[model samples]
Target chain A: MKLVPLGDRVVLKQLVAEETTKSGIVLPGQSKEKPQQAEVIAVGPGGVVEGKEVKMEVKVGDQVIYSKYAGTEVKLDEDEYIIVKQNDILAVIQ
Target chain B: MKLVPLGDRVVLKQLVAEETTKSGIVLPGQSKEKPQQAEVIAVGPGGVVEGKEVKMEVKVGDQVIYSKYAGTEVKLDEDEYIIVKQNDILAVIQ
Candidate 1:
């Protein structure tokens, strides 16, 4: 079953990190810090949340940077996703 | 300087835990779990926060139950306090 986050939550899928060296050697990101970048997968319908009126700013397919240590990780049908409040998202990349 | 919270933030002072048993024996609450209860010391004037319009709900001198681990602890003038969002407060005690 797919996750349907409530309130100002947004579903995000982390982008795979691939670093290319100057000589064009590709390296896995296993030894590096976990990237804070993710792609928006699902957007929650914005309305009132916790006594506040929230407006959804990010749409699906938008690349976003989220706060570290934010969101809950969920695994659904062999796919993993992070569910975070829209406020936890720091910025959208282009 | 006294703390003045911003946005929907609330400054709380933890209530001194004094439990009196049926036998009239006063007991300190240090052996038990940290109390989630606090007294509202300051309330922010709510407005637009993180692109959402928030309305202040709790007021100063109100006793509240806040979510555990949901606030930032600060020391001001040797007094410890917690600063939390209005959403972190679960209920106001009558």
Candidate 2:
């Protein structure tokens, strides 16, 4: 089943540390700390959420750095995902 | 210094556990878990925050129940307070 997030939530697939960084440095997956990087898989519609008017800034396929302790982890069809609000995303990787 | 929260943030003074519960259960202050109830000390001027428009619902003197793990603990003038987003507040006690 496909998971569709509501409001300003964005579904992300965590990018393992082995991915290349913006500075062209390739990190090893065996790194001690988990990376905060992820690729956006789905983005909620930008609209009013919880009495606030939110605008989704990240789109699907965007690589982003999110807050470490933000979002909820969900497992869908054996695939793990992290769903967070747009405000939790810190930056977009080039 | 007086803390003036910005953009949907609320400054709250946590009510001690000794306060009475909704059903009139008088809890002892020695309870192990910290109480999640607080009194609204200051309300932010809600407006556009992180590109979202927010409206403040709670006002000063309102007793509120907030998320257990939400908000930042702050100390001002030797008095402790919790700085939380308006959304973190779950309910207002009558």
Candidate 1 regions exceeding 4 Å error are A1-47, A51-94, B18-35
DockQ for every prediction shown: 0.04, 0.04
DockQ of 1: 0.04
Q: Candidate 2, after superposition: displacement of residue A82 in Å?
A: 25
Q: TM-score for model 2? A: 0.45
Give TM-scores for every candidate, taking all chains together and pairing residue i with residue i: 0.44, 0.45
Docking class of 2: incorrect
Error of 2 at B73 (Å): 0.4
lDDT string, candidate 2, B1-94, tens digits: 7999998899999775434544322333433333366789999999988877776777999876555456898988889999999877644555
Candidate 2, residue B38: CA error in Å?
0.4
The prediction achieving the highest lDDT against the true structure is 2
Span of 10 residues, lowest total lDDT, candidate 1 chain B? B24-33
Off by over 4 Å in 2: A1-48, A51-94, B18-35
